[model samples]
Target chain A: MKMAILVIAMLVFANQTLFEQLKEKCELSKNEYLIVIFQTPGNCVKCFIEPMDLVELIKKNSLGINYKLMALVSVEREIELKVFQKENDWKHYMLVDDGNARKDLGAKGIAMMIILDSRGKIMAEFLPNQYDKNIEKAKKFVKSR
Target chain B: MKIILITFVTLTLISSNCTMKTQHILEYKPEKLQTQNLNKINIEPKGIIEIEEDENNIIQQITSVAIIGESNTLALINGKDLLFYDNTTGKFIKKIEATFEMTDLVAKSGRKPYIDSNYERRKVEVPYISTTNYTQNGIDGEIAQQFIKNFFMSLKNINNTFYSFGTIYCYYIGSSEKSIDNIPVLFVLNDELNIESYVVMDLNKNSHAIAYDFYINNYIYLSAPGMYKVPAFGGEFDSYPTAAKYDLEGNFIKSVSHMTNNYLLKGGLKNGWVYPRFIEVNNHIMIVYPEELAVFGENKKLFDLQNLPFKNDSGFVYYQDYLRYCRSKEMRPDIDVIARLFPIKIIDAFENENKFYPIILVWDKNKPMGFYYLIQEYTSDGKLLREVALDDEPENQIRQFAFNKYDKELVLFKKSKTSWTAEKWSLR
Candidate 1:
């Protein structure tokens, strides 16, 4: 009974550590909230909206939120991405998730958005369209620095 | 100096990798290569292929074009719709709305009708059919069969041998027990758009190559692998065998043509520029970076290649590493545009009197870059037969140009003050 309880605690601690590392890697520990936009696999040319155009809104500062905006690009070319980031003066951070590392975390489908709290727990999740509907909700979570 | 020169010349036609073909590569003989005997020919404008204008200014340009049914050429604009125009007169034949079937099972609510007033194509939500489940490896022949029926471009399923269609499709293959497997599959649609066979082409997220301008002559010459794919139009030496000659039944024949990028790497280029055939004319260099076949010949051309590279005002850096004569940043815009330009050995092969004569369109260094093209026709043996100066008046500057092989005419997409129009010119 004692060994089983110990193993359970260790698993929980490991889960927390994974999230803590992700938060640190994304540099979101300094910020109160982070809104992550996950791109789908295999770029669909004729998708409902051009994925980059929707993501460009965050880069253009049109989102009007203090929350740290991030886009996870699922591409292998890091150098090309860096060149793009530097050339465009990409303000927000883009985590290259070529392996789909966050798939288990429920960030599934095309341009999926997920909001995480300071401690790394997912605070609020929005649909592809819900983020626009709940823009005020995202702003409310932004604790005053 | 001679030994190093011999090694470098031999490397140009060194051929492709494991998924490559060496059987059909033309034997290269540096000593026996032909000389330039090109007679100059005048470009005669036949007619204009007036592209139908979209008043709202949404359609940018024709992204993909294919010769369909001998008489017409199908143009895919902005990946939104397919517009058919007559090959001769450029008359509007018909237009089909390219629709998307939305199936985001994970983000259910996220898949709502995203209606934006500024742009209005986001409101569509067609039902996506999901049925494929991968159990075994190798080509999924059955799924390849289903893909043709799902091809959304045509108004209805093609009933006759009106066209030979080829599309690079991304299919999600995995069962409930397994994770989602993403692979790009190409099903060659021939004889009434029937998915008769399959070929394993890794034209995917990883490959720095693309094949679009393809012609079928028993074997599909789907734009040789070395196409103008990346932003640095001349990209890194990609190993993926995206270009190949395949029979109608999708049997691998030969990976016929390829430019050895490893040769550039050997020449101390780290991020290798997609430099076409190793040829130089005077101090000026030329390119063979077209859709297909940069006519393989002797490495004698590589010997004369002088590294005179030029940079433009728009931070447009051309020919980065291999041939390096930048000297320093002192290479300024005050220098003429011709000083900074390198010739791209363009591909549009010709046939006359039962003989194959490949056309090499060089950038007219005398005129400002992109304003004009110097069309140089060469015999199959690399003999420059004739050279014609494409009409390069500044007033009638063209935005884009293509040689319609079906009609045997050079179509120039001229950008006028009011709209973009295509002018077809005869090549004889």
Candidate 2:
């Protein structure tokens, strides 16, 4: 009975280790060319263009580059993202860090973009600017990589 | 038994820690407005001006009309013409041809007019005219008349473009494709249809398309949406609402980023919320939300919370009075309850005489629900004042409510689904 209990404990430990490994592997790190996207709850006519344009630009210029897009939104705004994705046919991974993202990223201003490298280093930060011009710069950066 | 006892004690302590303690203070409730025979009050239905007959006409299909002032005059744009209206008489006063269709108009009073006619005329210097013969003066006369005619036309255009001299100043922003870039040029027009000054508010290119001036304490608060960025979770864009303060001369005072701890829980930041309505009460600006209240106190510190005594669903924060009114949503099924199961819709707020209260109206299913009961709770201490219900209508919904300070009465505009005509009830 003691041997059986030991075996059960070993299995649980193995499962936990495997789960942690999976989480680490799947989760985005500070290093991997991370692009932080700040969005309001609804599809604002002009404000909604930044993310949609960025995704399209990235997809068009995806030349052997690894990048992850993260969304910082409110708790009340989750359903809006789903609707936006479904409507736009967007197939990008999303994270749900609402208020914390704003606090951590210092992104009190919406439509602000921050690009981080694989080393979790912020390489480029774009505050409120023309959407097309900023996206063009982001495209050039991705292309250079 | 010991384990169970310990578990219960632990649970109780955890629950107690989670609950926040709030102070409650008592205040007088205003007497309920008499509901005796609301039908007895004589109310004349204000005629609706059919701006256009075509279904495809944009201005005719106005989903909402936000009345900015109490004056009998209203400046309305139908995507084609800038229309002036006499509100009381429901008469179309005058139509001014605008260079571009504008969605909004801001009025500034007591602005001086400045005109520069030289800027209007582009004259080519006439070479020295040495007339040797006196018989060929007919051609010279025609040439001089033509020059004078062209000069006068140019002056007229300039006068129409930048001439203003009056107590009231109305500025209009014309539609332009260049709106995607710099701040749109605003043309100030006087009461006499003359253009005043073209004020260019040097707005950042990243600012949202819509902007408005909130007048408070002899100051104007200009609110604009900042840029949009992709969210961490991917997909849609998030918006940040940013604001700036400007003096009467259009001098930039300061730019403030309005940040809130509450954001979307799922993937992206809340980006699209714009047009924050400011309410000033006793030297305090109450940035009110349907659920939360952000009080810019006298100390200049911003206080925000959702811990008021009233339910979140039934309450609305009146920005002007710094009063939060909580009313029941009787008819709207889509409207969430106090727990925020749905979005809160505040129907109207009206005041009569010394007693000021906002009327809570909502739509449930096909029927309209009216929460005539009003309450005001302050944030400093949970001081509460319960006001009496003015009227009750289980079937008929109150579509609009207006308060006339001159008459010291609360006007309730009711719309019945059964009847074609709407009824108005005045509480004196």
Candidate 3:
């Protein structure tokens, strides 16, 4: 089930029209790397406030300018997501998924970030507990390429 | 020199004396929510049992576990699958072939699993899956969908039989205009993991659903929170924090009125739903409030820890902080706001020798290490028996745990890179 979702997500993004839509939605594009973040509810107190924390990190250039960002937020409650988005003022485009995107991407109940290349190939996947570890290597790889 | 000589003489006399009263002066129970009288019980870590997993059974995580004394097999739930292991040694036996699909009904993400209406007939193919919602049902509210015989929601053990507490949303499935009726039932399972018998515990409040269930010696106590306005249907909010009592066979015995919340129109403010972490201790219902522990005796008024000399100041506290905390995980744990400033939850309980103990994961804000977590054991009489420190590695060293009464061993499910392992620690 997870592989099928991944293949379908990859195929959708891999397509030219959908890729163009993605670029237009975020109003940004590049040939380097795209960072897709999967947000889930009910893990820790950290998970609930993650969007604002993440935005703070990006504003301080903590993530470095190696990739464009997209958020695949689990739409457990649409109103709650809207409140988070409004309060955090996240500039990146967020795709509201009522589907099992978090479960399929293996985020389960934690926040996950996957760095994908232009061809929809996963370059680096940073999981929960420690989302900062090995993130610099991915940023370096993206910048070097 | 004089004091030393007196001590020497006392020690000599004490050593010479044989008759001594070693039991029951009735240790004092605390009167307030002030942190006090907690003793640290030390236990050495036993060796880790690497639960071998293969291509077939890839255990990503575990949520709940039980030690089936009669069968001599330990049971665990990961997602929807129930895995069994040897009780003595934590060895993977087999993942039962009991995954049922709930097709006809739409996959409602957060609805209670009332679909277990087909449970009595053993119709394995009907009721669905999903363990997303956490209610007053407490920590054991995991693996709540359809497994073997629709066995889920509050998997508790009384002696040898496995009892599961669940809500049966019984309306006219035979076609009713009004919404479904709320009927909470307790299903007892046999040694072979079959639903032997069940009792329909009617709390008489059909409009309100039960939050948590605690089956003490003679009766079952449940926290039934009042109703809140639903967004989908746009309904009325009529909820009260009620501690109800029932018999083992699901009969409504009585109820104890609790101090209402000062927050919103209803319910205590906390993460993972209402009915603050509660337990039955000393024949009194111990309700974990924000800044207080409300205890109620049978057919008595709600009071604090010390008998009837207790007071409840719950009406002034607003529940919006908790509701906000549930939605936005911002941490501003003010004293009278979120008592459970951290993740306060009852992990699981165990019976050792002849006493009942509930294990709770609590946090100490002033703990030196920034975020100090320890597993606290509370005696049946509502005393903080002892606590053991959990390894603070940050990424989640211990996710879930189950205690085996006979062996007096605690099985901790720790996740490695890809596989899962069990660490056995004897807390005797």
**Candidate closest to the true structure, highest lDDT:** 3
TM-score of model 2 relative to the true fold? 0.38
True contacts kept of each: 0.00, 0.00, 0.00
When sorted by TM-score, best at the front, the candidate numbers are 3, 1, 2
Worst window of 10 by summed lDDT in candidate 3 chain A? A40-49
lDDT minimum window of 10 residues, candidate 3 chain B: B21-30
C-alpha lDDT (0 to 100) for residue B175 of candidate 1: 29
Residue B3 alpha-carbon offset, candidate 3, angstroms: 82
Across the candidates, what are chain A's individual TM-scores? 0.52, 0.59, 0.55
**Predictions: Cα RMSD each:** 20.1, 20.5, 19.5
- Give the number of the best model, judged by TM-score: 3
**If you superpose only chain B onto the true chain B, what TM-score does each candidate give?**
0.51, 0.45, 0.58
- Model 2's alpha-carbon lDDT is 0.37
Each prediction's total of clashing residue pairs, residues at least 3 apart in sequence or on different chains, is 11, 51, 7
Error of 2 at B196 (Å): 4.8
Q: Is candidate 2 or candidate 3 better by lDDT?
A: 3
Q: Write the per-residue lDDT of candidate 3 for residues B1-428, one digit (tens) a residue.
A: 99999999999876444112111111112133445545665655776766766545555445456676567776665433456777656677765432222211112322232333333432222222222322421212322331112223355555766665543432122221212333455656667776566566544422243634455457776665433322210122323434566677656565543433332333333332344434444444555543333333442324433221122333223334344443343223343233332224344545564444545444444444333345555555545566666654544366677766656677677764554667777776
